[model samples]
Target: MSAFMTKTLKALGLAAVAATLAVSAPAMASGGAAHPHAPKEGFSFEGPFGTFDQGQLQRGYKVFREVCSNCHSATLLSFRNLGQKGGPFYDEKYKNPNDNPYVKQIASEFEVPDIDTDTGDAITRPASTSDHFPKKFANEYAARASNGGALPPDLSVITKARHGGARYIYSLLTGFKNPPKGLHVAEGQHYNPYMAGALATQWSGDPHHVPVGGVLAMAPPLKDDLVTYDDGTKATTHQMAADVAAFLEWAGDPHATLRKKTGVAVLIYLLLFAGLTYAAYRKVWHGKH
Candidate 1:
């Protein structure tokens, strides 16, 4: 071939390679960077007049106890709290949660770390009503090492920590899906659209149409029939996720219901006081104006 013809063919090959790279190169933060917004879920305790669904709370607690406690901890909670007023297991008969038989039973089921008084050595003992929930891992480092360098966040206050609160938790638990074609998921990582993260680096498809969502170290934690509900609520994955999310929300703000109730009372008092004041003002000004 003539030197000019050879040069032209080389140029064409280079152009082809460049086009291939543009189509298949790892696209960073383009469409893949955009996080898909999760839709809001309605809950019993939402509006100013709203109250928590006692049955839902009870089921949620069950889900947490049976499944979530395996890897996540709720240090902020004491078993006795379950029997407190407005708690999941609250009973009118047991005014004091510490004395509630159910709470005691639940507490006794877990062995908490303690020191043997006689030997002054670390040991495990049956937990009491006052004891906080046992941690799943000894420390953050241990938690990370055990779970591919990712620490399972404490569920006690997770609802407060995340932006969408309970709804966010629900979305994440149910958001796991097969990644779009051309998306690269590393070993031990999974795709979840509800999780806030940039997946552009893992996207090997169209730059403008990269899939939404970020890579998560946690695999799908919820599945159908994962936890059998005591109340006989069907244990679908959606129900489990919703229940656990509700439980976590309550754990985060155990006093939230009480606070809302208090606000209502305060508003009522202000309204009554204002009405009394208006009557008094009318009486004082009667026939004097």
Candidate 2:
């Protein structure tokens, strides 16, 4: 009721309103014009209880190796990582990936460029379990030069880097289609609705027509039956997209399962501690308050 108290309450109310707006601004901006075609898709790793499907992850890896790897490089992933716990080959008999025969075979298939210690010259040799996945292009300049001036992004953490995460990747992979009537697609540009670079405007000059966005440099990378799944799962376009998205999500955060488990354990401990503290407080204050 005092003037000072009234001013203090008003300041607190304004601060609360400002905090709410700051929190909600990102949500609003994310749903705005830049991402018109971002659609949510059901993922096995969506919720707190969600876990990565090992089979799907394997299939996704195959899709990536056969298709996406030609353009995008997952430099962070190593051949041995595929055989590690929480990965596609986690159940292999050997605990050490280097000792796993399957992992060894996979690593041997790739020829890695190495420097010859004896002759100070570059040489190519079979990749070892220790080597990261080989990059298709030598560097960013080479990648951009090959892809019509647009550099192919690395797949290391693309799922986490983009908005909508797995769902956005899935949608973009499957969203390629013929441009709508009156929409003129430029040469060397592909039409993809879900791509952040897709443009909604025509090429013709019109003052009213505004540029929406640019076109994606990458084309529709996934196709039906592109990769043969060892598990007998049909390799449809949608299936490949979903599988690769899942795999990318895992690659982005290999320790997601452990993190979730730790979170649950901490939550349980906090709940038990709160209950014990409340019981102790009740006993201490009994018949006193």
Candidate 3:
């Protein structure tokens, strides 16, 4: 092949590679932009030495019960889990949550549906410690039907389910806002920068209607001083979001304390073993070299 032709081919290949990268650059940027609003906040249970603030967890549970529970369900959690060791309402004297009065009281507040054996008819009974958290709707279809075709997601393990976990939850809870000018939010859909749904509308007329991020089905459920904190911590929206995020993190990983403890113990053991091994090696090789 001629040198000139070879050089031309090489130039074309380089141009093609550059063009490919250029085309993909916006996609990569857009993917990152999707989560640009998720602010990473510090949590009490974040580091190795971290632990859940019992008071915060209790406050968060209150928020969840009053607000989020109206739609979402924590199916993996039971009333008893609330009063278990390392939990918010744990009682040292009543390690078994069944014996915990607080647990029983919380359980009794909810009525579980059941079928009567003799009557063969559905009946509602007070919830027990063993009963899982009840769903607000009977099923998915019912949930969607009630909420204008938007299904409220089950919050069991939600902290683990999302990409950024607790921080993401906190951000999302506090991130709801009006869409920028020229952006069209559809009817029944609320604007949330951190959620994953988009509003439906033709974008030809509006300059800013360029496929913005997803719309939240649920309205902004939190507000300033929404829940009166028993501890007198100012009930700011940020505070509530943080507390609820922490509580959900615990709900998703109830054994986080034990896991961290075991991890610390193992690390200590490994360090001691390493030191002892080095000492023995020095003793064995002393004066030999």
Location of the lowest summed lDDT over 10 successive residues in candidate 3: 24-33
Cα deviation at 27, candidate 1, in Å, is: 31
List the RMSD of every prediction in angstroms: 19.5, 6.3, 12.0
Indicate the residue-level lDDT of 129 in model 1: 99
Q: lDDT tens digits, residues 175-234, model 2?
A: 777765556787888766555543434545553553443457678888888889999999
Residue 62 miss distance in model 2 (angstroms):
0.7
- Regions more than 4 Å wrong, model 3: 1-41, 197-212, 285-289
Model 1, residue 5: distance off in Å is 92
Question: Which predicted model would earn the best TM-score?
Answer: 2
Q: What is the per-residue lDDT of model 1 for residues 1-289, given as tens digits with 9 covering 90 to 100?
A: 3365456556655654564454223223222333322235567665555566778888888888888777788998888888888788899998989989988999999989999999999999999999999998989999988888998888889877876677777778888988888999888889877777777788888888767668888888888988878788899988888777777878887877787678667656655665565577667767774
Clashing pairs in model 3, backbone N/Cα/C closer than 3 A: 197-214, 197-215, 198-214
Ranking by TM-score: 2, 1, 3
Q: Worst lDDT window (10 residues) for model 1?
A: 23-32
lDDT of 3 by residue, 112-227 (tens): 89999999999999999999988889999999998889898888799777766777788788888887666667787777666655344624455544555567678888999888
- Residue-level lDDT for 263 in candidate 2: 61
